[model samples]
Target: MIARWFRLAAVAVASLALLARPAAAQQILRDAETEAFMADMSAPLVQAAGMEPRNVQVLVINDPDINAFVAGGQYVWVHSGLIAAADNMNQVQGVVAHELGHIEGGHVIRYGEGMKEATGITLLSLVLGAAAIAAGGAEAGMGILGMGQQAAMGKFLAFSRAQESSADLAGARYLSKAGVSGKGSLEFFKKLQNQEYRLAIPQDDSYGRTHPLSGERIQVLREVYTVDPAWDKPVDPKLEARFERIKAKLVGFVSEPAQTLLKYPESDRSIPAHYARAYAWHKSAYPDKALAEVDALLAAAPHDPYFLELKGQVLLESGKPADAIPPLREAVQLTNQPLIATLLGHALIATENDANFAEAEKVLRNAIARDRENPFAWYQLGVVYEHRGDLPRAALATAERYSMMGQDQMALRSADAAMQGLKPGTVDYLRAQDIAMVSRAAVEQKRKKK
Candidate 1:
């Protein structure tokens, strides 16, 4: 199962969306398998861009919009819709290449340059308009103000277009350097071109838009890509196979059960089809059907950690936590993935056996140690602490989870509780104090905003 977390971040200009807005809260979808796949896919391109693989992150946003963006760091956020829309892994790699260009070029950091230029134009126009009004030329003042606004907009749009063009070129160069074909990059641009046609977007008027027309992008990229040595190279078969499974899994997870079933009919019987149908069945509350699909998958690849994880999730969510333990335990041992370990810990705690509490505590603590960003693991750890009658530590865990979810008021209260209960000058007491201070500051900031 994919976990969802809320985080506040800025959405950058390197998006396919026509309209732009300020920083906002976004829902991030986290799954061990999807994240691992994205990391693997983007690693080559990240290295080609002269960055450490560990430093660059590819995050999946739980949005249905067909877009990807860099939010002011070495982070590339891809909408789930983009994955559903892609035909193959190479197409997504192409997107990764382009976003890496934005990261490497520091476009997000330089975004202020364009805004400053546009603001200057608008301010100048305002001064001129004021002078005209003072001279009693009211009509001329209004006309000057309107023209100035339009000119300022045009200036910003032009600057944005230049950045987009530069990123495209840089992306092509990175793809070439990585020995990856640009065919997928060109093909994805064509997909955008077709989408523009479908949406009845104006193709000729590039001046008013933030991005260059997809047709223009294709035309420009095609020239560079066609000459690249890797243009005709074939995608890796193993990687393509993984992409297909992930794409199907995402469709099943995000789409309506009926739509998933329709898209991956029972008659198909392939691994990806099985993956899709299993989720569809599970979501529809037919555990038997879902288990049957899982069994079929296990028969095909018994050692696959993800399939085992899915089986465990289905069993656990279906109210059979005891039954879910074996597969989930195996999944944890096989992968040592924090997400899988979190699930296993949940299964242990859900069993309600006091003997299982120690194991659950250990498992949950280990999972949180490796992935401190996982709010769910922290919440589960809180549950374990409460079950063991450790109120102070439980409150601290609650604070940790709430802080990650941006619920600062709740975090502040929990941290306050933990601080009062714990011994002064101890590590946990100090951490509780730190949380309290940070949460109080965040709460005050929210009050000011309101």
Candidate 2:
């Protein structure tokens, strides 16, 4: 199921931007469940590349383009569209493995260096355009739109054809070492090639425009993989099923309800299809139907954490926080995922039951310890503290929440309030001081820009 946190974070511009390239023209999606799923699927490839799985961050970009790229250190940004468009697990895993190849080869640093020598018109205009897109998206695109198609493509295209071929070989090796077939990577490239052919007339210069592609790249990939013994290995059915469910979950939440229904109709009795329809029904205001569908799913796999989470989320959002507690608790127990634990904490807080207040505080604190970047968990911690009448601690938690949301001014205020009552040099006091310092810097930076 699509985590409610992502839906909430989507509308929050400042918070969302901070999680991504800060001031770059990229849209970074924040979804705990989706990210965890991607990480699980890509762990083997990352390990095979001799990289730490924890160090490699798999970020989702909220774009409809069929592209994946690596930027900065240990960051792989996959477009939501690519995931939704992928036919199976291997296709998506191939993309992940390919991007990992770029990282392992240190292509990002080399490309950045190459960009330094690109044509001035392309360089300056693209930088400014990216900033504009980062700052205001469509509203800011107006100024750079006139820069024209040439400048829209970033300087990273300066990557040599040799680099592309090298990445193809490296990616195939990683896949082979990880015991995964390389066929998906080949298929993905051909998909791009087919797209290039269809748009051969107008040339939609969106994604993959920077990457050098040629007939030889495909031939090289085919030649490299065809000889490997693992080339024809079948994709694991369980892994494939997980990918299908995730793709369906994303479509159910992001696509129009009518469209979702059309894609997964009543006759489609698969778990993923039902999962899709449950979300569609929930989104379309058919609450009873949504619950019914979820209940049916539970009948088949009652202990499934994700299914339990879906039930909990549906109930909680539909104004039954008290009712939402049991399944959320069960889900948390089964999965031990901090995301689900955080959701359960939210449900506990929403109930406003005096008896649940302490439990909520404990739950939120544990969640924050494990997933500190989650703004909602911090916010709920503040809510719990406030309910307990612990004003100073409440303010500190509020400050942390505001800091995560990129509201530095509010963070400063809350931190200052926290400092007034928090004990000197203690953990809470030190945290508040850190918040004050960071917020002061952020506020000053904004003022200077204006």
Best by TM-score: 1
- The reply for model 2, stretches above 4 Å from the true place, is 1-33, 119-156, 160-164, 201-209, 214-216
Q: How many residue pairs clash in each candidate?
A: 0, 0
In candidate 1, residue 136 scores what lDDT? 100
Model 2: how far residue 401 lies from native, Å:
2.0
Per residue, candidate 2 scores C-alpha lDDT tens digits across 1-450 of: 010001112121211111223213655666556777888899999999999999998888776777777756887888788888888889888888877887899875675454444344544655666788888685566456444233423333333344555777788889999989888877877777777678672344333333455344577778878888889899988777788888888888878999999999999989989899999999998878999889988999988888899999999989999999999999888877888888899999889789988888888888888889887888888888888789999999889989978899999999999999999999999999999999999999999999
Backbone clashes counted, model 2: 0
TM-score of each: 0.94, 0.83
lDDT of 1 by residue, 50-148 (tens): 999999989887788778888676888888988999999999999999989989999877777987887788778888988998999999998888777
Estimate the Cα RMSD of every predicted model relative to the unseen true structure: 4.5, 8.8
lDDT of each: 0.87, 0.77
